[model samples]
Target: MRSDYKELDNEKIYLVTGAAGFIGFHLSKRLLDEGCHVIGIDNLNDYYDVNLKKARLEIINKYDKFKFFKIDLQDKEFLEEIFKEHKIDIVVNLAAQAGVRYSITNPDVYIQSNIVGFLNILEVCRHYKVEHLVYASSSSVYGMNEVMPFSVHHNVDHPISLYAATKKSNELMAHTYSHLYNLPTTGLRFFTVYGPWGRPDMALFLFTDAIMNDKPIKVFNHGKMKRDFTYIDDIVEGIVRLLNNPPKENKEWDKIKADPGTSSAPYKIYNIGNNKPVELMEYIQTIEKHLGKEAKKEYLPLQDGDVPMTYADVDDLIDDVGFKPDTSINEGISKFVEWYKEYYEV
Candidate 1:
């Protein structure tokens, strides 16, 4: 909601890592639009397309209140310099080596970026005394758990991919900082975030691109996979609602029967998702309908580090933020296709 951003103190400086990224760019723009000064950081890595990342930055650069820096998160020196340069009231750490399948081949990058980079973020947030730190965690951390609707309270110790492991590690590291340094932190477990300016590596983007060009789209798990495909705007709204409300010490937290999502310390985790899962075929059909094209599907077995379904239990998110993602796939896909057509002139 715009009201949430309007109520925020415009004097507060927000540091957003991965400002060139899909989520980071959108979040940075939203903050800037609300008159909040923002410092953006990104390594500008060629994880996918460097051009696309730069294009996102081009839009963010237009804002007078927004400042951009091209720096890797593992470079703690530069990161700390940024902390010293600005009295950052809030930090949203969205920079990470994304992609589950890519992690299977490139485990080293995951460790370096996701693990070490995140540690640097935690260290800076602890020392700088940032009022709140919000970072991205993924529903991929629900690895191997056959749970229908994954809950934050569920134990996510069985991550199958290095990518998922790194995200889970982020949540744990943030909790440790919250406990040791009294740092306020919140980890959002996002589910299938997609929309215009979205990452090209995601299924929705890949499917759309292939269908538009009349290429055969890879249909994994014989098109039986399901996902809680959340729209980018909804995800941003949920994050905005939580930015000002950092977690307080849960005095009622049961140590005997520990809850993985919350602690006696100032740390909490919530799943920001649509709470409704859609079949892979249905998602593809929606894309096709918007594109006015049919995809040549090639059926395949479930790939490595891939799950058949992901449905989020967003009760905590709804209860805490009084918000729920209600954007239908049809509406979201239609907007994405329109943007795609205009951007690519297809």
Candidate 2:
């Protein structure tokens, strides 16, 4: 275990953008549970169900240490005011216009939220002198790569979707800030995260809802795809472990090799994944087993922006955080089914 996994001081405040989103909600709740003050910000956009976002906020609002703001990251003046009002020690940027397919028709939202919004965040972090800035990068950034287990060290210059491109751009932007302003930045490239309180658009939730309603579930790539389906709890655990352990200048970094994951400045990137890929068919089967109903399948060709597989190389994550996501598909799916049933009252 890392020695830095000590109790977080309540005096230190954390700013979590997209606090009502899937991962952000869980992360903010965890910090509040740890007796730390957390400033939560989210626009609660209609990209997903607004009620779902409100439901997540309802849970976090129970905690006295949690404060929420309904604001967009692109609004620099409002964001600046929030930073000036609160002494934020850490900033976790998780707000973004998510989804590969949506970006096809709604390209503008991605640029607005992922690009402009992120620039606003970088500026705020730079001005505020935040101890550490951890932002969400996606496995989608590993676009067009045939590698089995995607590593941060690999070149990710090719992206098939705008969403992926924006995420990659965030890394580049972060590196520039780190180099010029001496800000410590860490970007987490999360794999296919799923579990209780998951997004409605994700495979697990969609499969469960369709299967329960006797609707046909779209099986992309003819069910031959594979993904490192990480659980939300595990993803949150990795982020919490890294809250205090900011990146430092890698003295041994060489410009000759041009490694993509680390920099001479205080900038680093790591893939937070299960490190074990599961076939799409097998994953669906597990969900079916828990739901006690098989899904009506509509096998479809690979979507334009979709990849056939995604496998995360989390060796560096294990070495640095001393933890790995090991939740079995069976257990994780079962828990989701339980939550789905109770939440929807199915």
After aligning candidate 2 to the native by TM-score, how far in Å is the CA of 6 from where it should be? 5.9
Worst 10 residues of 1 by lDDT: 1-10
Pairs clashing in candidate 2?
Answer: none
What TM-score would candidate 2 get against the native?
0.98
For model 2, the run of ten residues with the poorest summed lDDT: 1-10
TM-score of each: 0.97, 0.98
lDDT of 2: 0.93
Q: State each model's CA lDDT, in order.
A: 0.92, 0.93
User: What total of clashing residue pairs does each candidate reach?
Assistant: 0, 0
